[model samples]
Target: LAKEGEEGAVPGPDLVAAMAEQFAESANNVIIEEVNKGLNPGMIVLLVVATTLLLFFVGNYALYLYAQKTLPPKKKKPVSKKKLKREKLKQGVSAPGE
Candidate 1:
């Protein structure tokens, strides 16, 4: 069945076929050119390095978070006598020296 358009005539099957063939030929040419050139080694190396660095950082960060969640809390260091006295004074307790 022939399609009717505002112009009173639609594109014939032969014309459509020819247009499709031309488009396919151009697309094939582009594909062939890309295949011939292949991938850029420099770009591939850069991508590999970037991906390695990204994964390394991500793995380290994930490990850090896991450690924070799973590891025991650190023991507090012993306070010096002077620091203890200062803390006591801050809490309104007089130092032993008066």
Candidate 2:
């Protein structure tokens, strides 16, 4: 009967403290597990963003090169020293000397 009484004795404060500690540790482990489970989705999102930026830059570069190749060449203007001097004189501008 003494053994049974000892077994049935209410837990002391120390025992209660130990139980609380174990509960806290288990809760922490559960939270960590949940975070770990979400890691894969975070990595997938990172990969998708990187891929989108890469494609955008590549397409922009290709379009720029294509435009350069397809556009017509610009016409060259002929320069005349007499015309330039006349225009500058009319505009009240003068070159280095008379």
Model 1: which ten-residue window has the lowest total lDDT?
28-37
lDDT of 2 by residue, 6-97 (tens): 86777778888999999988987764433445558888999999999999999999999998999898788987888888889999999547
Model 2 segments beyond 4 Å from truth?
Answer: 1-39, 74-87, 90-98
- For each of the candidates, give the backbone clash count: 0, 0
Go through the candidates in order and give the C-alpha RMSD of each one to the true structure: 7.3, 11.5
> What's the residue-level lDDT of 38 in candidate 1?
68
Collision pairs in model 2: none
Q: What is the lDDT of candidate 2?
A: 0.85
- Number of the top-ranking candidate, with TM-score as the measure: 1
**64: Cα error in model 1, Å:** 1.3
Alpha carbon deviation, residue 19, candidate 1 (Å):
22
